[model samples]
Target: MWSGDELDLDAYLERIGLRENPLAPGELRADLATLYAVHRAHTAAITFESLDVLLGRPVALDVKSIEGKLVHGRRGGYCYEQNSLLAAALERIGFEVTGRGARNRTRGDSLLAVTHAVLVVTVDGEEWLCDAGFGHQGPREPVPLGRPGADVEQGKWTYRIREEEDGVLALCLLRGDTWRDLYAFSPQRYHPVDYVVLNHYSSGHPHSSFVGRVIVQRPGDDVRRALVGRELTSLHPDGRIERRLVGPDEILTVLDREFGLRLPDREAEELVGMYLAGD
Candidate 1:
């Protein structure tokens, strides 16, 4: 059930260019799934970068700020910004969405509030987990919760979900015979402030990857590419990076050309110089 206070349905429908209200419960199940797919494609198509931090600007988490980035022809964002916008969209389309916190497996079990925003949907007497954030590990479709084993696909990857203690859930990928942890969460409710605190850490913590690295990723009609600290790799439909880059000079060109990212002149110079120094 959606209320005007929780979601601006008109604005959300307009944002997605859907003429009818999507959040009407009966139609919401499929509509919400469609919205998640739209968000995943939208986020994947746009490259992630910390250019805002580089420009000495703080990232905004509101709907206007989020819609502007996606619609106003600007760069895509990291998890917090990406997932928040998706949550708003879901709410407007008539899905019951509440913000929740997840302990990122990569960042260790730190319980950092709601660093990620995920959608919980009730369909046919069951709840499901829907996430279009998490970059490489983002869920392409909603995975059924309360299930012993469930499979969800995003791009070329398949994720498996397993039940944990109490209501907590663990999501992982099947790596041959072994499972790899991506992240874990529960149905715990959270507020916007939770995301605010985590976003602050993600952008400011010295040990955080975003603070120390320049990462950008984009997907074309046929290929998806990522640039991490001067190395660029383009993956094909077969999940192979046909081209592997080795220098900063190439990274700059790829950021601008491949990802539509505009780096500051000084930052570009510093990166190129650092790459040349072989550090």
Candidate 2:
């Protein structure tokens, strides 16, 4: 039996706004279209956030808690939690999914923490890279792995990828005339135990920004919305930017309205207080 029995697959899909499975029960195919649909729905419905870490609570990466937090609890999480939830759902729907880690060059140019997580999904002998935890600047949909595309801004910021030496692939962000490296990873799969260690450092270590800050993001077709502490930003595809400062009292309101999350009032207050406390 699929591990999905531990989670309400129907409810999880519903939570992600997929009212009904486009592919039938036994007819589900692990094709690019299906991957794209699920990837898009997940990024749109479930947010990429670090609320639990900011609250100093242990972030759970197990399938059960990941499903519970995103589905019934109406919560969001960072890389480990978000991708775990997506991996579970995809596996239940007949996809061959393997967890992979990226050296998060976006945060720092070091590989000390292989922090970012992405799923390597095989469909018809081709591996597709799928990620739902990359907050605002991640791929808007599943992209073909190894055979990276360039200047492909389909409801996402401009990004490109290239094959690197030693069997690793590098994903980059197009910044003006320069392409800045965002992350690098090989196709080697990761186990759940690896995430446990990384999650500890990401949520507890003093140098990790996730520990003491408020960060939440959800991506859309025309724009991206994110909250870093009191600041709210709306990034448009047409080179337009909109920014605002959200007050502490209204943090919960913004999270719910813009990010599609409804955390408890008390927990919301605590997270906001920690963010306002500053480093």
The best candidate in terms of lDDT: 2
What TM-score do all the candidates reach, one by one? Answer: 0.73, 0.89
What are the per-residue Cα lDDT tens digits for candidate 1 across 1-279?
222245444444444444354533345444545655445544545555655553345877776776666545455677777667667766665556666677677565565543555656655567777665665445556776767576665555566888788878877864344566767788687666677787787777776567756666654445656676666777554535555655755757767788876555776777677677765
Model 1, position 23, has a per-residue lDDT of 39
Flag regions of model 1 displaced more than 4 Å: 1-33, 107-114, 153-155, 218-225, 233-246, 256-279
lDDT computed for candidate 2: 0.77
Candidate 1 weakest ten by summed lDDT: 1-10
